[model samples]
Target: MNLIDFLFLVFATLAVGGGLLMIFSRHPVSAAMFMIISMVSVAGLFVLLESFFLAILQVLVYAGAVMVLFLFIIMLLDVGPEGSKSSKIKLLSGLAGVVCFGILMVFSLILVLNSYPECSSCAVWPTLDDNNLVLGQSLVFSTSVKSFGFGLFSKYMLPIQVAGFLLLAAMVGVIILSKKFVREGNPS
Candidate 1:
């Protein structure tokens, strides 16, 4: 395969492997670190797709800010390694997981079989064509960013606002839950 394809494969493998490792990790800190690796790998994939802006945003928002906040929370909570599960419980869980995976594979196979290629000549929305000008003629604006902003602010504004409010509420709840109350008179 080509260099780009090989790099994409490497990044994709890292992303998926890191995600699986994060899910299976017993330690919260280890899981968070794995998640960071997954996020950074995904950012690399974005770079491969020629979306440098998205790649930078992905690293900045997810790998940097979100991961730092997650690591901080994990440290603050002083979380310990999870207790080991009974062998019987593990066996049953593994069996259930295998069954679910089989079902998902079947569905995926069916989807792949039924899928058909679209007309190659059809024009994609928010065309990446150099002719489409936005704002001024001095600089050519990226249609992806422009269309994303327009869609987010116009059509999906309400849902986005609701999600933001929900996130804010959750953050406040977490802060409240983590707050340590000290008794005024107790010196011990």
Candidate 2:
């Protein structure tokens, strides 16, 4: 009805449509492009929701880093068009997917019907409100972020270090897997 509502609907439709295209596209590059489009649309939605931090994080983390990794794999692996082919077990996979989606939809519908919040006539984001200030303070100096930092340093430090090492190992593994190696018994 209103301009903001129209923009929200357009962004939402673009996000969902692009996500579906990403899921079903046969070409890896085309799927990646669709995924980027979806991520951008979702970022736009986050902006509409007045969550600027979340919007930036979504673009930086998902669109910039994760998508770079995905595209790198798609390109560096030299995966042909045939690489996107579905296996013979498609029917079973499709049935499982449909069942999972049905269950999820039922749960979501129940949640929406039973426990949905009442919409207030007040603007969603009032300017310079106490709640907004509190949210900002929490994000900047929260116990949660401090706890996360401590956990990184103490409890999960070794695992974090090992994860870095494992990533390095994976890079090595990828190189080894992609290389043409000759066995002792095989002709070069």
Candidate 3:
């Protein structure tokens, strides 16, 4: 309808389409590229939300740094597109995917049937200006980096820590998986 709504729809479509393409792709490189597209679209969504810091982060940290890392690893591994699977396996996987898609469609139809009720918030963040801060109402949501940092530290700390830990674990897992292990008796 409006420019913002149009942009939101575009970004949301790109994000979801890219993600699905990434998942279904057999080639690791193609999947990584699709993931970058998804990440950039997510950054666009963050921009639409008026969270510039998060948008920059989505671009820089995810689409830029992480994707580069993933691409480099994929290249180093010399990965190829997946080979054909057994027909039985393929049939079962296809059935599973269809079942999952059907479930998602049902949920989506339910939401549409209900006309998409307005969301309810557990905690309503306050609106703050300089005067509000001066009046000791510092815990408020804004488009500034300070409020963003406050939210990250106060409300979203656990998720942040969990993400960091997952990244560390992934790094460790990569090293473990890539390490060459020699047999105990044979030096060769």
Candidate 4:
């Protein structure tokens, strides 16, 4: 195996392991931290694929901003490890999780079987002559900051505005709910 293949395997393993750990973790904070690890590993995989712009954006948006927001929500909600439930409920939940995992595995296997290329030489992306020039010249309009700005403002302006308003409303709601709880002397 080449160095690139080795690195890809490492990052992919880290991403999958982190995801599993996040799902199984009892503590909210631990789960969030594991999610961050998964996000960072995905960014690393993006970098390996030579999508530097995407890698940086993944780190900034998901690992940085999104994770911070999640952590803030957890703190504000005063979330902690899940409490004990009845054995019947726990068994049902475990069975549901196993069934979901089996379904996911079947879908993944089908996708892999269907997507395999018939042509051995099929390339998903063009090979760059100079890696350094990929950002400045090759994919400038496709993956650069300027292109992102243009696309965001031109094609997705409405969605962006809607999302901003939704976030604002959610923040306001959280504040109102906390205040009401405090007034009622029922923090729980």
Candidate 5:
């Protein structure tokens, strides 16, 4: 109806479509590109929502950092469209994916069936003058950071520590995997 609503719909559609394409694309690099498109579209939606802090974070964190890391890994591994040389486990993997999708669909349907409150009923975030000032306020003014820390430390501490541990494990795993081949080439 309104201009903001129209822009929100457009950007939301673009984000979801791009995300689907990214997930289903055959080529890894193409998927990454689609993922970038999705991230940017989501950022646009954040802007439409007047969440400038989140919009910039989405672009900088997802598009700039995460997507670049994905691209770097893709390039480093040289994984092309035809790079999936293992067809041996295709059927098993496909069955697993279908099962997981079915479970998720059922859960999502159940969630939707439980009618929720109107979107307008949700508590709206304050519209800040500038994005950077908003971010600074959130990080320092205890508006967001205090509540965030409360949630993180109170209810989510274990999950946060688990995530940190997983990241550390991933780094170690990568090092171990690469070391195997590195040692094979150099006798030293």
Candidate 6:
């Protein structure tokens, strides 16, 4: 196999393995660390895909900044190891998860078997030709930082702003929920 293929395999394995480990990990700190590992591996995959700008952002934003924030939250909340679930509960959840996954896989397989050009509307993607409006424009597919920034600010501004507001709201909710209220002059 080629070096690129080998690297892709390595990165993909790390990404999946880290994700599984993160999900199954009992300790919050360990789970967070595993998530960072998965994020870094995903960044490597992005690098392989030749999207350097996205790769860097994935590393800087997800693996570094976001992970630090998550770790901070975990520590601040003083989270401890998870308690074990009962066997019946675990069995039911596992069965439900497997059934859901099977349904999703079948749905995806049907989509793949049925449609390609039929999936997207003729207006949005008329043809696979390079001369097509969406495909012709570098703005849609370019990996350069300038193009990304321009597109994000101009075309995708409102959704981005909304997402930011949602994240802020979640943060506020977390802070409010975790707030320790000291009752005035109440002693045990």
Best by TM-score: 4
Task: Score candidate 1 by TM-score against the native.
Answer: 0.72
Range of the 10 consecutive residues with the lowest summed lDDT in candidate 4? 130-139
* Candidate ranking (lDDT, best to worst): 3, 6, 4, 1, 2, 5
lDDT of 5 at 42: 90
lDDT of 2 by residue, 59-169 (tens): 999999999999999999877665533665787788899999999999999998889566698664554432221342243222233444654676668999999999999
* Each model's Cα RMSD: 5.2, 5.9, 4.8, 5.3, 6.7, 5.4
Predictions in order: lDDT:
0.84, 0.80, 0.86, 0.85, 0.79, 0.85
Better of 2 and 4 by lDDT: 4
lDDT of 2 at 114: 88
1-188 in candidate 5: lDDT tens per residue? 99887888889898999988988899999999999999999999877765566788899999999999999999999987864646768778988999999999999998987865457755555433322322433432232334555656766789999999999999999888878554676787
**Model 4 clashing residue pairs (backbone):** none
Candidate 4: residue 148 lDDT (0-100): 60
How high is each candidate's TM-score?
0.72, 0.65, 0.72, 0.73, 0.59, 0.72
The clash number for model 5 is 0
lDDT tens string, model 6, 1-188? 99998999999999999999999899999999999989999999998877789999899999989999999889899999989889999999999999998999999999987876554545642322323223345545555666667777877899899999999999999899989878889853
> How many clashing residue pairs, candidate 2?
0
Which is the winner by lDDT between candidate 5 and candidate 6?
6
lDDT of 4: 0.85
C-alpha lDDT of candidate 3 relative to the true structure: 0.86
